[model samples]
Target: GASSSVFSASSLASSLLSPFSSAVGLASSGFVSAAFSFTGDSTSFFTSSATTSACSVLGPLQHADYFGLGKLLSVRELFEARVHLGHKEGLLNDLMRPYLFGSRLGYHVIDLDKTLQHLFCALNFIAHVAYRNGIILFVTRHQQTAHMVEETARESHEFAHTRWWRPGLFTNSTAQFGTVTRLPDTVILLSTLDSVFEEHLAVKECNKLLIPTVAIMDTNCDPRLITYPIPGNDDTPAAIQLYCHLFKTAILRGKERRKKDEEAAARQQQEAAGTASDASKQPTSA
Candidate 1:
């Protein structure tokens, strides 16, 4: 039976604010500002903030930027590649759920943590591949987990000295289905099965007809429901932390490519403008 506890914004807020909410709030807000200001010129504000607070205090961060040199790939392209690999390896069903239903849901509900960890690892792996291929990645989750991701990103930036994290959008019970319509071509990372299951189901159904999805599968979730199901734990803080780190690394790698592309484009535009100015200044003796 589905738990009777209703998912609420207040509950999420309380969960996020429980201990280091102040720091998370600062980092999340800072990340948003930085993502938008990710032109080629400005200093990475989020990285600066993380250095001052989270990373310096947490320890060394794993730098994901080392894997950013490759041809660009899209989320859909990565999905297709994974599907091809799974099919060639005869692991299609093992890697993907055709349809999520009754007994499958039961299996997921039984061992949530291990299931979530598996799911996390798989998603992380996909994100890693996507990053290496130069594809952009974004993760979206319910508010509590989004807060956790932001906190982890801050820690990673501070420790790793890399500017590659963004704040995940927040969703709640009342508006659980909100962001799906706005999903970019990037991957979406869902967290906290109990809170976002309904929305997750909604997304699964919707994507079944149209969009391709990659998801983390906890034991509590029906594997059949997710396109890419990783069986593992969903309840442990350690599991969540591990998954978020993988995601942060992937996104950071993508960001590095994006930065380089932007710089190249800017440089070309400047050269063209300079050429045009030079032509205009030359005397036309006809």
Candidate 2:
């Protein structure tokens, strides 16, 4: 009877401590969650904190209605690059009035939303042209953008003119512009036509030859001349860098797609030939 009483007392003590132990476990888990909670639309659980902190270090995030250009750079990054900054309000052209976000301290700011829209449109068109194996000639007389334009053309296996554009490069026939054998299918102007007065001849020649032109039009530049005008801060080094990188990337994507298509066609032809050969080798039942 005395041993049974001692066993019952030990069982009672075990039951009394079990609730406190469960509560401690639950409290520790709650503390863990409170201390390290992951927030944000990121798939990375470990790096989200770091990313969020870095983003906050810049400042509060501005809401941007992004379409597809986010892959190139976030809207915030575009803002940081000063792509929205434009010439003084007095310098803005009437045609570019619609693209202005508003005036800031006597200077007009180009709307980034409009910039993204036009940029995506231009990039898609460029990619399509590149896919067709068209010759793209980059022309930029502006000294600041010359190196980047040349480098971009080199990387994409295209052509570029960093120096003064020779008049009649496109419009003049082989007989007139004697050593040139061919002309480019498309022209990409890094700076607007006004940047180089001599380059106006190239623009006129492009129009005469029916060659499509893509131009970066600053707030002060006229947009009516180019086939595809991208309103942006073309003079900013960061903006130009973004433009060059994106155009090169788009061309590369198009070239890769074209190569894939060519390979697929070749494979299909080979498979058809193999099937025909196999059929011919089989004996015909009379």
Q: Name every residue pair that clashes in candidate 2.
A: none
Which residue ranges in model 2 land beyond 4 Å of their true spot? 1-70, 173-176, 194-199
Query: Tens-digit lDDT track for model 2 on 1-286?
Result: 1111122322322322222223224211111110111122111111134434543343111001011223554446567878899988887789999999999899999887667656755675676668779899898877877899999999999999877556666666676667767788778888765444433566778888777788888888877768778888878999888889888987887788778868987999999999999999999999
CA RMSD, predictions in order: 19.8, 21.8
Q: Residues 65-150, candidate 1, lDDT per residue (tens digit)?
A: 12321123122322222211111122223322422221332242223322332333343334433434433233444544566755
Q: Per-prediction TM-score, please?
A: 0.37, 0.72
lDDT of 2 at 276: 99
| lDDT, residue 178, model 2 | 73
Model 1: lowest-lDDT 10 consecutive positions: 29-38
Q: What is candidate 1's CA lDDT for residue 183?
A: 36
